[model samples]
Target: MSVIQILIINAVLVSIAMVVLWLVSLRLKDASIVDIFWGLGFVLIAWMTMAVATQDLRSILLVAMTTIWGVRLAAYLAWRNHGKGEDSRYAAMRDHRGGSFWWVSLVTVFGLQGAVMWLISLPIQVGSCETVPMSLPNYAGLIVWAIGFLFESVGDFQLARFKSKAENNGKVMDRGLWRYTRHPNYFGNSLIWWGIFWVSASSSTLWLAISPILMTFLLLKVSGVALLEKSLANRSGEYRDYICRTSAFFPWPPARRHGSKLV
Candidate 1:
């Protein structure tokens, strides 16, 4: 199939999936379920693109990388968010919108996310249709992907474990990967897409660089680092100190205060 046809089909599929998920959220009265669906949405688009396009090694690799990232992300969010009720962001929106939140969420939350997902999956859609053999750039991209996966997965695990301990409650998470970067998971997430873009880059597909750029921008300035940090900004002085010392979106050694105390 042509790349345009593949994108059109994926767009339709994503819209349908979002609508169904929106309906389910209405039944559950929890728009936060969309968070779990976020990763899976990309997985769905990747696999569907591979199915309709050339099923070569590059496409298979892309699909596999996406699946690994998406499934792990979905599972982690599911586990962490279980019994947590709606996320505060959606709850606040619900309160602000009153009764209209149900339908508002359908358009603003589900539909918007679906559109972003489709746009971000452009690389997968185009790469799957390219019919190219695995090359050095592909292998290098895989390595980059592996590093991102490790950081995201391990950072999440560490945070979850830390949060599970009652003693750590209300404390800044400045340990493990969190020490080097305030948001290892977000950093890793941006890297994942950059790696995917690298794998997908070609003479024709280079235009799709916007996909990863958008993803990184979202992770840094939109939903990931900026949003989360804003919420944590007033939580404690320690978080402010953490921000002063740790890298925001990159891994670096923790900064130290006078007397050799790690900030």
Candidate 2:
């Protein structure tokens, strides 16, 4: 299939998926479930491309890496959010929309997400359509992806464990991966897309470069750092200190010892 054709088809698929989810949200009365499906949305697009597009080692690799990243994220979110009521963000949106929340959510939450996920999946769509022999970029991309996968997986694990501890209640997390950065998971997520871009891109496929760029922007500027900090800002003196010392996105060495003040 041609690139444009694949894009058109996947756009429709994504729209339909979101509509279905909207219906499910209505039944469950929780738009937060959409967060759990965010990763799976990309997984659907990747595998759909793999199934219909011409297959090559590179395409297969893209699908494999995407599945590894997507499935784990979705499952982890499901587990973490289990029994939790609607996420504050979505609940706020629902409250803001009043009686129109169903349609409002259809347009704002599910529809907007489907649109962005489709844009991000451009690499998988473009990359999987072309056949090529594996090269250095491919292997290099895999290595980078592995690094990101570990950071995301391990970082999430560390944070979850810290939060589960009774003594850590209301405390700022600054251990393990969090010690290096305030948002190791977001950093790892950015790396994952960039690494996938490396695997999928060539001179001809360079147009797909925006995939990782958009994902990085959304993570750093929009949903990831900006939104998260609003809640974390007033949590404690320890968190403020952690923010002072720890990098926001990229993993870096702490600028000061925990609980230390700057001179």
C-alpha positional error of residue 198 in candidate 2 after TM-score superposition, expressed in Å: 0.6
RMSD of each: 1.5, 1.6
Query: What TM-score would you give candidate 1 relative to the actual structure?
Result: 0.97
Q: Tens-digit lDDT track for model 2 on 126-183?
A: 9987766666886798888889999899999999999999999988889999988999
lDDT of 1 by residue, 67-186 (tens): 999999999999999999999999999999998998999999999999999999888988887766667887898889889999999999999999899999999888999989999998
- The prediction achieving the highest lDDT against the true structure is 1
> Which ten-residue region of model 2 has the weakest summed lDDT?
254-263
Quantify all predictions' global Cα lDDT against the true fold.
Answer: 0.91, 0.89
**Model 1 alpha-carbon miss at residue 115, Å:** 0.2
